[model samples]
Target: MTARLNPDLLHRPGLAAYRLSRALALSRIGSWHSYAVIATPRAGMPAMPKGYSYRIAAHMGEFEAVAGVAGVDLAVAQRRLDDGCVCLIASRGAAPVGVTWISLKPVREDEIAALYDCGGRAAWDLGLHIAPEHRASRAFAALWAATGDWLDMHGLAWSLSRIALYNAASLRAHARLDAQLVGRVQALQIGRLQWLRATIGGQTTLHLSGIARPPKLALAAAIMV
Candidate 1:
């Protein structure tokens, strides 16, 4: 019998606190703690691999092909489409296998929030997802290759993305790609008071959450429609 590995066990040393924080958050009794990583993907793209077809979604209807696979409904996907963000989806035959999203907009979007804004120079690498069944395949490389090609042709110099620090494997993978660490974010939520401190692009900022106030980075809920 082929034995499956417990992914968390592979990164046990670094996950104890991460898992504890998740548990605390689920229990709804204490502050949750975790680190957010700001990664700057350097100039260049991954090698294009075969076995998958790619689709780049720049508008509404185009995104529908992969919305369900990407985890957001059409409304949310359409909102992102209108925001100048692009989503690259991959499929094996007719099965959606992976997705990569990026943005060149300088303004914040309601879906992405402000903490993710990396600035004007870098295209926001909003997200990258590969179905578990395809995680071990070239789906990632193919998705990135297509994304990189698009970014290169669009005159974008680089891509900036946020990653959860507890994802050790992902962090390691990013390092292998020569992606630079741009900053770190720490946030805590307690009762009705929430706080966040971030240091990105050499600037440090703090924010207190409230219905009447937005993050210092985002003065108001972004209305792009």
Candidate 2:
């Protein structure tokens, strides 16, 4: 997976020093832990608002519309949709208000490998986003509930997702849906070398990758999203 850095950080001075410091810290210690939450049939879905509705996009046109409303790249979303990724779009009347992506196969962007090892019965939910104006409402929760329902209808027994440790809002949202924390993942990096470790309950696995780069080059290759 390609590392995506926040553009706002690029203009700041001492970026090299900052990147080096972060890399060193991560290598010696580790990046913040990301929690893996699971959704099952027993954890019932949430009720959407009176005027809101959710459905899987039926075509690229619908996907493009939703992507436009969500401020995401139309081409990227179309590619994912073409590759069999599912896009759930939530709308009020005829206007899209929220969108989420789900995958039955492995998604490299999520950077988690264990979920895919569970055979094709597992689903991964990612890229959940709600319009700012609808944030205070139950849109997100409703979308999640709909996703769970979709998973069940498809005969999938498990739904998995990773949330950053510092994302309290997301954690609370997942908690409200009765999602169980089944695992955690952390990353470490030094120069071009990077390591990713996952702990599912008591089991742990580590993966390492990267190219050789000058120690002082300060490549920001292991940033947390």
Which candidate ranks first by lDDT, i.e. highest?
Answer: 1
Q: Could you give candidate 1's per-residue lDDT for residues 56-100 as a string of tens digits?
A: 888877777666668666776776777678888988777888887
The global Cα lDDT (0 to 1) of model 2 is 0.57
**TM value for model 2:** 0.70
lDDT per residue as tens, model 2, 11-104: 2422443464467565775332334333433244565668878888846877765665565677767656765678888887877788888776
lDDT of each: 0.62, 0.57
lDDT of 2 at 71: 54
lDDT of 1 at 17: 47
- Scored against the true structure, residue 50 in model 2 reaches a CA lDDT of 81
At residue 199, give the lDDT of candidate 1: 65
lDDT of 1: 0.62
Q: Give the TM-scores of the predictions, in the order they appear.
A: 0.75, 0.70
